[model samples]
Target: MKLKKPIASLVSVVLLSIGMATLVTSPASAHTNAVSATCSALSVDLQLYAASREGSPAEGYTEYQWTRTVVDNAAWTEYVRYTYTPKKHGKADPADASSTPLTDPSHWNADNKTYDNSAVDTYIHSGNGEGSWFWWIATTHEAKTHLETKWSKNEPAGDGWVKTGDSRFHETSPAVEAKTNHVAVTIDGTKVENTDFSTTFTKNYPFSDKYTSHTYSVVVTAWDDPMGTHGWTFTKSGSSIACTPPVVQVTAVFPEPVAPTCTTDGALPSLPTDQTGITFSWDENNSLKMVANADKGYVLTGATFNIYEKPGTATGDCYVPLEPVTVAPQTCQVGDGGVADFSGGSITLPTIAGVTYTVKTSGGEPVTITDGKATGLAPGDYTVTALPAEGKILTAGETGWKVGEDGSATITVTVGASADCSVVQPDSKVTSTEWADGTWACDATTVKQTREVTTTPYIWVDGAWVLDTAKAATVTEKQTRDLLASERTVCTEVLAAPPNTVVTIVPPTCTADGSATLANGVGYTWDKTSFGPGLWTATATVADGYAFDNGSTYQVTFLVSPKLTGGACSVSQVLAAPPNSGTFSQVLAAAPNASTAAVLAATGATPLPLAIVAMVLIGAGVVLQPRVRRAIFTRH
Candidate 1:
């Protein structure tokens, strides 16, 4: 029973021991295999700091410090070393025993001395029961020295170096705290704020080791002020001081003003007035005279005497002074006195039947003459005189004239004749004896007579014909004689020749009756004779009383023209009547017999053959007219 108990206990012990060993070892083995598996799966980023060599100190030395970040696993811990070496037991041993110091193996210098471990192996084991293990180690795996370091020691410092406290140290020290501050900046006299300010610190000692210094920078944010802030306070390192802000300048803007001027409307005023006493004569009559009251005064500056008239009126008479005539002060006042004279008054005789009167005077008291004349003159001839009262003398006076008895005031006159009247009577009268003879006696006609008479009669005023009463008469007369005898007897006795009187007669010619007739002839009458006789005379008188034979009957002739024969006859003829055809009878004379009468008749009747033949042919042609036409037609 004791043996069984001991054996069972031993078995139990072995089994528990084996089970615990399996549990622990299995986990360790799994962890190691998982690490190797993770290393196999991860991408290996190999960075070398230095070549592998014998033992050396890993101070102030870096190989992969400048390299980029790479993926690493737990297997990467083998590459961390102080120095580099080769393999051990047919496997790489990055933590080699030969790279333990950083000094030379053959010599030693205390001033520049480093850790010396030359006498060492060149390889190191990596598994259980290997050489002494280190977290970082240098390697000499390829017969060359190499260095490796921790990743944190060989990274970039964040905020770079800065000036700080009494001792310079890496800001990563746990004893130091970080802070934030600001700096000021200005631009063109305006301010800015909230500029980023930062700095860094590093260690003073550990010359071979590098420390990340705190870095400071300005981000330069903007502000409302034009000038900006570029200053920093000692916030993180607390070592910076303050400074004065920079200055800037500027200018301003505005506006300006203006000026003024003056002007006027039109031309200036003028003046002209008449003088009182003095005859202020000028060479030119049209000179301008200053008026009594124009404006106050003349603006002679910048003005010329353009023209002259009244103020504000363009057209009055202008009297331009020969020179500039300045009026004496107060001379134009009212109630001033002056004088002119008219002294010597004289009369003159004109050469052309007229009169002239004149005043002869010189300068004296001012006075005028009243009405005055010279009297006591007659129509014959006279002379008159005049005398001036004061301050004068007569220069021309006496005159002469030729006068007449007529009532006229002229210096010369002529007389003319007066009117007269008269009557004229016949010197002798016709006698009674001449009237009693009973011929064409003008005295027996008893026609009243008149005479033209003229006389100058005077009325018995104061017993004589004084100058006012002369008168006259005038007459004229016409008379006629009466005849008591027959007109033929009167013509024979008074207007005929004595005994052998030869008379001219114009006989009658053809009339409308186609024969000459005495009733169609013109007749005449005569005046009575102073001595009686029985014979009578006649003449053929035209309707105007002109005798055709001119009262001489030496030969009697008549002109005749045939009248147109109408009624189956047409003839044109002219003839003349014989002279002395009418019978003349006187008392106690023998009668003419037939033979004498035939002679007389033959003489009186001379046949015109053309007229006779024209009548006869007209009668014959009228009788044979139809037969002749019939004979002509038969012959044709």
Candidate 2:
């Protein structure tokens, strides 16, 4: 049973510990509560601390109890009347007892005996109002068997009296015995004050002040001193606490953006429009300018300038004297048609005072020029003619001009290279002695030939050689020469002529024309005139692209005779001539009568066949007979 008691205590402790685990609750956050108490004169203060005042409702109930011992000494005495009746004597009268009070135990009598003498007794009773007890009232008396005497109080008799003697006088003592008392005082089952009170304890409570307020309960118990055996008394106190949260402030931060960049070498830069810190404008110099306030807490620093195009000056000149002017030249065989090769030739005119230039072909009309442009020229040799200003003479030899002493010049275009003698050769000259017969000899002439000569006659009046208006003249000397003997003989005597110089004349036929031909292919035209009957002379003219041999004409003579059968013939004849050196004369026979000639002239009459009695003569008196021959004739 003793072992069971210990085991039961262990089981109870384990059960209590396990139950406490389930009863435990989570606390707000991980923070613990702080509490403290202080004792002072007649006052006690309690304090609680925590992360915040808001948490599980706090429990701070306290009890103050006290215990003490005290001594109590109270005393009292009472008197009672007793009547004694003897057994043998009939009812004796009760009386008050004095000596040997019922309270005196040793004086008490018993054994169913009666008091022989009734006496009055005094009794004492003592109590602290906690309990009461009575003892038998005793007296020294002998009981009578038949007559009993009972002591009775004036009031009612209580128990604890053994009825030992029907009535006995009970007396109370005057002093009561002293007693020691144990006293205890308590509040809410706690001990304090007179019991030497001192204690320390800590307890945790859950609380939270995340939003609303929560207060901590902290109780303080105190007591006043118990004067002498008086139990201690106490009063309870607690601290007033309200949890409050501190105010919190929050700040926001943002990320900064990268600054925009610009270029100097490319086209116009596009500025950022969304940027708040940058501004753009044109300065007074018309240059692009940018400003940045850096309102976003950034630093702006760099070098900048305006870009533009600058105005510049350039110098140049146009010389009027070097202005282009053209005067084309032509190349040709002398006296033939040709064109100038102006493909590579041009000129620059000058503005010299009193100097003017004219252009024209040799032996052609002058061409007009206005402002360095000239009228077009035909295919021919040309000259750029000019005259020097007054008081300025032509520069000799360098101007390629035929300049005169009068200061005029011509730009003469040479037909060939400057050194070619064929283009610059001088005219030939011949001197011949005359025969004593008053005729020039053929092989006896002395020839004097002039050497070729070239001259630059152009005047450089305007940076170029130009023809002068006044040009040097080429002088020609006329010399007359008589024909040579061969020429004269050939001219007078037809057989003496050179074969190339021979002339053949055909005799005229009554029905056909006559012709003349020269063997040298030197074509000629003819001229004829009449010198009376049967006498006619004709002359020859050489054609173009041909020349007479040393300027002489040859001649041939021939004749024709006809016979007539009737006196005064009525027949008529006409003759046709071929191409010859000169024109031929028309021959007509006198009509047989004036009326017949009139009729012939009037009707343009046809001719009748008849014998002719006429004479035909050529050159100088040469004659021959006529014959009837058939031939064709044409007038030319």
Candidate 3:
């Protein structure tokens, strides 16, 4: 009997990553440029650290826990996020008061979104309330919150929490202890009436969303004092040393889904997962065959499914005789005297089910049926179709029997069976393009490029032969991995670089240059600064095991070039080398800065000798000086 409601449909995922968005948990970063020039009057540099509370639910339980808190330094860090730009001597003119620089010898200011310690950041646990008393108490039914904040003029609060650290407020706080040791009541640079008295921060719970997936922005604060007792001794630029506070963001993800459960309830147990038991194996005749898991006692309803298919592409027509008298069994051809293959090339195997056979007359001649089955037939020739209780119908080929044939005429079927499909490639490469175990290769018999395994599987369960997708056999997969072909001795292509720079690449060729090559990373440069314009190339003297595609050769190309007398190039111009390796009209063969006479008299053997060229140009210019022309013109 079919289930009243499909179990698969009833199963729903409450929490979905449909849109797994990120919640910024950390505070907007604070910037500070504040460090007192001298510590003479600086009271102390105190660092207060606090942890952001984190909670998680126990597996399979509804209650959640505040396992531990991650420390958040930003709570106290924001107060002194002053940019410390010290004055030449003491402090800037508007020191500690104005944000910008002033000429005042000992003055400064801290602006730029400075923190206001005067007011408490009440909404520190903004939006999220996991650690808030309201949220925690709601779940635990507690009368009061265990967490506390307070200040005191008494000695350090020591190990135990102070119920009432000070008359200022009856609360538990870190600053309760530090106030005891000091002679003067001083926290940060602000002095208290008594060295004993110090103030602290307390929080009032704000309303938040009910517990669920959320981004909680909570800032916890803890105090660290040189006294090392307790209570906060917060300080600023005027009283503290230079320090940087780190900002960290924390995010929470929904827990994983619960595993499937099995119970004695009327509902069917979960179906077999992953087509582990369904398989197929071809008999000698290549007729349809299936190997699968039996339903045994687990099946509530019996399983019966049909397999339908046509001949494979290789076979033009599907026809396999039950007894091949005329043709060899192994080499039977399609359209021979046998049952033809299924219609769609392959059988559509459903969950395991019985395949029953019935013999009916080829043509429609009213035949009597008994007990909902074919019986008592005086047959001439009849067609037998394998009617699977579930999927498709399998052809049993045509049969001609005597009027009084025995049960041999009865249908044969395996109660529970799915598609059987899996193949094994030959250990070595083969010339065959398509083999039973699907493997597609490169060369006719050289390399195997890809291999695959495909199948459809089913397992018997809950009595009925329903589609066992979970038990379906794994489909075939094709994969091509790392291939080994020696690297060719060639450059792949030119790369981009800075102005006036070019690169040449040499592959670690297979067997051409032996091992004389460098380790693939060493680069060589040709100095052309003083040598006038000419071709320049950089080569590597190292060799590495990296391989290249196709047959390439040692190659050189320009990547960067600068100021071209004419042409579009990337790198800055190298005076000596030709901009690129091609012949062109009026290309500067030599450095343009070279002397004019040097170009006129330049030879391939040598560029103009630097010393000689300079002297020659200076001496020639003196003789051509125009002042001498005045005397000559006057004589003429």
User: Distance from true position, residue 383, model 1, in Å?
Assistant: 60
**What is the full ranking by lDDT, best candidate first?**
2, 3, 1
User: Per-residue lDDT of 432-546 in model 3, one digit per residue for the tens?
Assistant: 2332222322222222343344343333344323344564444334444433343112232221221111122111111111011111222333333243322333332212322
TM-score of each: 0.13, 0.13, 0.12
Alpha-carbon shift of residue 421 in model 3 (angstroms): 26
**Predictions in order: lDDT:** 0.26, 0.34, 0.27
Q: What is candidate 2's TM-score against the reference? A: 0.13
Q: Write the per-residue lDDT of candidate 2 for residues 1-636, one digit (tens) a residue.
A: 679999999999999988776554222122222343222111222222111112233333322222222224333333233322223433322323542424333433333434333333333222432222222344343332332223434322433333332343233433333222112222223332222223222333333322332322333232222232111222333432333333333222211223222211223344435544434343555544432333333333442333433322322221112112344433233211111223223233445544577777578667676675454344445666666654445543544556666667666442221221122322333333332232332333322223323232443343334544354334333344444344432112112222233344444343333323333323223232211123222333343433444465554332323222344545544432333332221222222232334433433423311111122323322333222112222111
- Per residue, candidate 1 scores C-alpha lDDT tens digits across 587-613 of 111111213233234435322110111
Q: How many clashes in each candidate?
A: 97, 50, 74
Off by over 4 Å in 2: 1-351, 414-636
CA-RMSD of model 1 = 58.2
